[model samples]
Target: MSTAQPPEDRNTLEDSLDALPELSYSMELVQKVQGGEGGAMDELLERYQPRMRRIIAIKMGAKLRRQIDVEDILQEVFLIAFRKIEGLELRSKASILRWMAKIAQNVMHSKVDYFSAQKRSAGKEVSLHGLAPSSDSLEPQISAGVTSPSQRAARSELQELVDRQVERLEPADYREVILLRDYQECEWDEIGSLLERPTVAATQGLYRRAHLKLRKQMRKHLEHPE
Candidate 1:
């Protein structure tokens, strides 16, 4: 006959798993990386690398500033974030996103500062900031380029008009706001968690405003198309 497992052992195992929360587990994984978990550390970096790259793309306006090499910024952001992520207080994924945003902002600022210093050293105003991408900044950012007849005709055209307006957003900052709210059908609370906003209502309003702007822009695109 086998001996019965102790209740306390089962509870302890559950608690350990619970520490890795499903809601915003990415944030917890980052925390674990700070605590020196090898697997968690690697996963965290891999997961956000693409996102970090996209943020860099928008910040440098890669299309216009062909020389910016957004990857440079991604490296810088990761190095800094790896250092400071532990200090951040993330109650949800929204909070985690805001933390990531802060890191991106700081990385861009430092790049600006470095370039400005270089310009001063050379006695010229030729700083290394990139120009913004065009309204058609497709490819990796706007177009995952999913092909289907369903998205090929009028609907595609209509959606492309809306997409242009989205690119005009605060340089890759609010992509989650659009993707989650409209594309993924995420609820307002989930959005608020990612954005660090105070309430679900606030997130809803943010999405509502975006939708209104998209509609206005879509009408204009259809009217012109030139």
Candidate 2:
């Protein structure tokens, strides 16, 4: 019997295997802002604000989606960018977006850790007999024999590894494609717009190439594991 992988594992495997396109409007805005032109930062923010919010919302995950406020995180991300933009060396438009995404990812991870700790502490006060089996308890069964905690840790590590590899990819377009499609989970249309592709099909082809490269990198990582 063939056993299905857990959703997280499947998505991680599929998504990890994933471009920037030509310089467009955002690139010009990034150049202007980097050059310290007046009102350029505001224009850049205006252009990317929606994209940033979408990225934060998607990365927040389902567990924290209801509990955490995306707007607050979005504001904090932009605020940090505002304060630190001068010091940052943004080589391309993709670099700026990726930098912002990293900040959002860090903030979201910290929040998840905080809430998880709170839940763990509260769990300890409850009677073991009174507690019901959680999704955690059923993880192995749901994962087709893989333990949840360990699998989750491995998945997280793999994602981090893939992200680092993506940074080293040649042609900034490939890096941007992975960041937007895989990391942020944006739709092809949106990705196409950002990448300045004429159609979703063009963007899809770009993503496929990027994914193949990422898969090769992952294979190498597994083989070496250093």
lDDT of 2 at 90: 52
Alpha-carbon lDDT, every model = 0.51, 0.58
Q: How much is the lDDT of residue 124 in candidate 2?
A: 34
Model 1 clashing residue pairs (backbone): 93-194, 94-193, 94-194, 94-195
Instruction: Summarize candidate 1's per-residue lDDT along 39-148 as a digit string, tens digits.
Output: 78566765555444444454455433344556666667777777776687766444544566567667666666666677689896544334222112222222234455
lDDT of 2: 0.58
Clashing pairs in 2: 17-211, 18-210, 18-211, 19-173, 19-174, 19-177, 20-173, 20-174
RMSD of each: 13.8, 16.6
TM-score of each: 0.53, 0.44
